[model samples]
Target chain A: MAQLTYREAIARGIAQEMRRDESVVFLGEDIAAAGGVFKGTVGLLEEFGPVRVRDTPISEQAILGAAMGAAMTGLRPIAEIMFADFFAVCWDIVVNEIAKSRYMTNGQMTFPLVIRSGNGGGLRFGAQHSQSVENWAMMVPGLKVVVPSTPLDVIGLMAASIRDNDPVIFLEEKALYATKGEVPDGDVVDTLGSAKVLRQGSNATLIALGNMVPRAQLAAEELASAGIDCTVVDVRSLVPLDTQTILREVSATGRMFTVEENPRLCGWGGELASIVADEIFYDLDGPIVRITTPHIPLPAADALEDLAIPSVTRIVETVQKSMNS
Target chain B: MSLDVVAPLLLDDKLDLYRSQFALRQFEKRAYDLFLENYVKGTSHLSIGQEAIAAGVARAMRPDDWTFATYRGHAHTLARGVPMAPVFAELMGRANGLMAGKGGSMHLTSVEHGVMGSYAIIGAHLPIACGAAWSAQYRGTDQVAVCFFGDGSTNIGAFHEALNFAAIWKLPVIFFCENNLWMEYTRTTEVTAVANPAADRASAYGLESIIVDGNDADEVYAVTAACVARARAGEGPSMIEAKTYRHGGHSRADPGKYRPDEEVAEWLAKDPIPRYHQRLLAEGASEAQLVEIERAVNEAVDVATEEAKAGAVPGEDLLMKDVWANGGAEWRN
Candidate 1:
């Protein structure tokens, strides 16, 4: 087993795919000669020529459009949008074309393309550069959205997304890019619509996604010391949500709490809560509690920004509140 | 010996290009009649007068090549050999339509025919066409993509994005802009500062481009053929601007009120179908033979309408079926 950081794992996965299939190419703002904005595509241009590893102009719409064009014609293109905040510029292409093409054409077309970008927050990238737009993509019908929390998950999910026939949105948390974890060798093909239970418990289930997964695990560990058995679940994919797994865990524990960094109103947590209420309402022993950022613009101050996202303390408190109810 | 490029189809290649335009003209007339009788629902932008541009450009591409077009896509799809029945059924909102009636007149699609789909969202199809070209070139296929947009689409931000992408990636695509003078009610010159919309923009992207007399099927065929050949050979993308005129209204309901009386008459005289018909006659297509072709066209249109009338309208249950790659919310559970 090799200790690989999330960035290195993604780079290795891309390099492996590019080597195996010549049609696998990449285009982004500084992905080629400059490696990558986050160094996830580092050393790719050196391994593959400039013909395959391209540096595109500062146009998110064009990068996505070109990637889709490449995907439709027989190429497996991996496009980078620099930052998740820039995804707003390319929403029409993402939501309408790439997402809907396969179903619109009666399953005749396969858009095997991966759109990867960093969603910055705790690094203090500010309002323009530090927003998670995955919820917006999850709201769309056709896209398969993924948020990997660890190095191994990044490698495995990136590999699965490259081969999947549907369009995939791979969001890599900017702060977690360098976080190291053991990524085992050999075949790495992770399923898209499955939630991983990080910690098993009997008291309550704490469901989280992307960067919040590690915090939920930490909360569960802290709760374990206090004799509160907390089950932690990581929702790897968002659009075709693994509701069955969520329901199964909730049914066993009889209590549920969702933790997310996104704002409260119309957020991914809201959708998950509604889904649980609609399906597993009778099994719940208490009101499903949600630990999320308040419904306000993300603050710019260092302390305020740190307080805006969900902390392990906040998750533990929310779980305690659910249990007391 | 140097490997010679198969030259673009000339006006002299009457059989290849003429048959296509002829099919388009007949399809439009038939579709118009159906539209009048409430057979095809939704707005139908009939490509009655501007048939040559679509037919000529599509005739230039290979079978495996891809195309994305505007709402006025009958000409493009018909020229690409998508079965006439499915197209008409699609317009009629039948279950047997190209998109299984999910898409109406403005959104006809046939991936098997390499026609990605027709978009009603103005310049929205340009980026999709660019994507298709990228996919084709990535797979190392000789196939190229052709995007057909109206003069109105030139003003959209998507047009700029698509052109820039194609130019930078060196993707195999031919951006065929049919400048039919008017954008619904406004003229092209009124909205655009560029002298020639597609050609002028092509130079900005460092790509080869040319403007042709769109009514002249020969010129349209020649220019499109060259661009298509260049694209297929991996020389990169090119822009072809066909300066033609729309004889009918923008959509099914609107009358041609904005146009001057004399302008309408002038364009009618230079109708693409008749001009090409005269060329066919001069090139030894006998009057008796020409009459036979016309008769066949009229008959084909009649058969299409009959089939469309009998086709089943889509059920309400299917409303949410194709919205997801998997069976959607139902299958997710």
Candidate 2:
């Protein structure tokens, strides 16, 4: 095992896949030469050359449509949409074309394509650049939504998403790009729709997705100091949700707390809360607690942005309130 | 304007084009009747008067070349050699349909025949066609990709992006626009600024573009052949706008009252099938041979329709099938 940053791990995962399969190619804005604005595609252009590492124009519609076409015609294309917010410009291609092509073709076509985008708000990039739209993607039936928190998880999930026969929306948290963790040296492939228990506790269950996983972990540590043990679960693949694992964890703890960066209304946290209420309501000793961003656009100013987003302190307070109730 | 130099066509080639066009017409006519009889559910955009474009383009393309078409793609698929039985079965939503009753009329695809897919979205397939062409070039193959869209598609962003990309990369692709002069109920003039969409934009993309009489199968075939040759020769992409008209409504329901009667009458006078038939007779082809071809086409359509009616409707289990090629792990029961 070797230590790698989240950005490096993602690039390595793509490089490994491209080496293994010649059909794998990268298409995005400034992904080539500039090595991606986030440096997620560093060293890829030099190794793969221009054909495999393509720099497309600022046309998300064309980028996604071309990727769909290439995938249908025997090429594994990995398209980067730069930021999750930019998907608004090409929403039709994603919802209507890429998401529906497999079902519409009735198994006649296979879209082995991956769309990687920077998601979430922590750097104060303003409303347009900072938004976690995983919930919107989860609403679509034919797509697999993946969000990895750690470097190791990103590596494994990136490899698995590339190998998947269907379209995958891979969301990389912009803030977590520089975060460092130990990634296994060889090929590390994780199954989609599987959840990982990052910390073990029995007092309460803290389920988090993407960047929220680390915050939940910190909250769990704080709760442990306060004599309230908490278990932290990383909801890696949101679409094919690891519901069984979540149910088991929630049943064991008898209390559930969900965390996400998206707005509180109709967010992924709501889905988790509803599932717990429907499946394991009797086991819960207290009401389900959700720590999420309020229903307001993220501001450019640091103070207002921090206030709107869910913080570790907020998670701890929510957990304490649930414990008291 | 008609071609100054008419390309020479052998008797066999002329007969083949005529037979294909006849088969397409018979198939579409029967499909319309089936829709009326309630055997084929859902509305279909029929390409009755645009048979020449489909037949000519499909004929010009090699078997290995890929084709991406729009919603009105029955004729395109037929011309590409997809069996009539599967086509009808698909329209009838039977198990023996082209996509096993999954992709009905608008989404017919035959990977074996190199018909990649027929997109329901007007301009969505343009970028995809460029990708397929790029894939062929990346894989070091001379195979070209042909994309068929309507005049309205030119106004979309994807159309410009695809043309620009194909031109810059020098990808082997042919953008064939069937300018039927109507985007559903609206005339092309109302929406688009240019008179000739394809030719007007070709210079902007630094690619060659041509305009052809879409009703003339021979002319369309000749124009497509030249574009195909240019792509195969590594001369990059070319656009061919075939100016034709739809004889019926955009879909099954509309009466197409929006179009002027005089305009419709003028186009009706240039009906491709009869004009080609007359041309064949003028070229000393016997009338008996033409009759024999028509008889064969009619018989084929009848057999296909019967077989499709007899085919089984897809069961409930198929509802969850084909969501993923590897069987979606998330949706597995």
Candidate 3:
């Protein structure tokens, strides 16, 4: 296994898909030549050339529309929204057009496209740029939402998304770009809707996604020091949710906590919590706790932003206090 | 003045264009009757007076060339030679409809017919056309993408974005704007900033200011044909604004009470069907030849209406299919 940062993993994943299929084209603002604003796609344009690795004008609708049109007409395209928050300008294309195309066409036009965007808060890009809006796509019926926390997942889930004959919203956590993880050399393919049990325990089950996954693991480790022994699950794909893994783990632990970067109202966790209550209500020991950011616009100040988003300390305290209660 | 070139169409071509337009007129007329009879459910935006543009543009396009149309797309779909029965069945919401009853009249799509999709959202399909053209460019294919939208869509962000993007990339695509006088209830002239929404804006993107008499199929054909040829030859994108009118209100619900009777009569006088018939007759087409096409089209439309009226509503099993490639809407398994 080779150590790769989350940023490097994005390039590797896209490159792997593009290499595999000539039809797999990547486009976004600053993704080509300039190597993307985040530098995640640093070497793509050099390797794939301008035709395959395009740097579109600052038109989110155009980029996604092009990606959708390409996907429907036989190209497996990977498009980036620069920031996940910018989906506001082009939500019509994302939710209405791209998502509904396959179903509306009755399987005549399939959109095997991956819309990659950097999501969640960390670098104080303010409320407009910092909101974790994967749920925006999740609520839409025809879309597949994927949030990868680590390097390996970035590569694997991206491939799965590209190959999958549907529009996949792949949100890369902005905070996790610099984080490193061991990824196996050669093709690293993984299945969508499958959660990884990074750490196993019996006291409680802590499920997280994107930026919240790393924090959940840290919180789990800290709580273990106090004899809590919580399980950490990276609930990777939100659409095809790994309910079996989460339900089994939650049932075994008899407690559940959701660590989410998005605000509290109608987050993916709420949907999952409702499902857990409906299916595994008898199995639960206590209330399913959702440790999420407050239902407010994310603050910009470094201190306030850190406090607003659920951190390791917050997760640890929330889980510990809930477990004790 | 139109950007009409001197490429004269053959007598057979004029008859074919006449047939295409006559069929569309008959289809829209029938569709309105069905709406009154409560057969076409929900809402529909008919392209009654805009037949010439869709027919002309579709005629100019190669069979493999892609077509992206808007909510007012019944004419465009029919123009691409998608059989009338399925389209009518789709309007009536039947299991054997063009999209199996999933997409209603506004969202008619037939990939096999090269009719990519008819987007309900205004100006949304413009960029999508660019994408299809981009794919063709990437694959080094000679297919051009023709996108149809309304004068109202010119003000939207996607239209400008698509124009600029297509121009820069020089993608084989044509942005066909049907300036049909009104933007729903409001006159398009009042809401729009310039005299010509698409043509005036074309210069901004370094494209030619090409406009045609949208009621004249021959003019629309010549201009769009040149644009298609330009795109196929890798000369970049073209913006063709077809000046036209809508015979009815924006949709089935609206009575079009906003327009004065005289103005409506004036445009109706310029109705593409009669004008094209006159042109075809003037171009050495026999009266018998035109009458035969009219007769054939009327019969086909009546048959389609009957077939559509008899079509069964889609089964419940269809609901659980095609949301994903697995033919299931299962978020979790």
**Best model per TM-score:** 3
Query: How accurate locally, in lDDT, is each candidate?
Result: 0.82, 0.89, 0.91
Task: For candidate 2, write residues B28-117 as lDDT tens digits.
Answer: 999999999999998798999999999988888889999999989999998999999999999999988988788889988998899999
The TM-score values for the models, in the order shown, are 0.94, 0.97, 0.98
Instruction: Arrange candidates, best TM-score first.
Output: 3, 2, 1
- The lDDT, on a scale of 0 to 1, for candidate 1 is 0.82
* lDDT for predicted candidate 3 compared with the true structure: 0.91
List the lowest-lDDT window of 10 residues for candidate 2 chain B. B324-333
When summed lDDT is taken over every stretch of 10 residues in candidate 2 chain A, the lowest stretch is A100-109
TM-score of chain A of 2: 0.99
| DockQ order of candidates, top first | 3, 2, 1
Candidate that scores best on DockQ: 3
The C-alpha stretches of model 3 lying farther than 4 A from their native spots are B1-7
| Candidate 1 chain A lDDT trough over 10 residues, lowest sum | A101-110
Relative to the true structure, candidate 2 reaches a TM of 0.97
| lDDT score, candidate 1, position A313 | 88
| lDDT per residue (tens digit) for residues A4-58 in model 2 | 9999988998998998999999999999999999999899999999989999888
Error of 1 at B152 (Å): 1.6
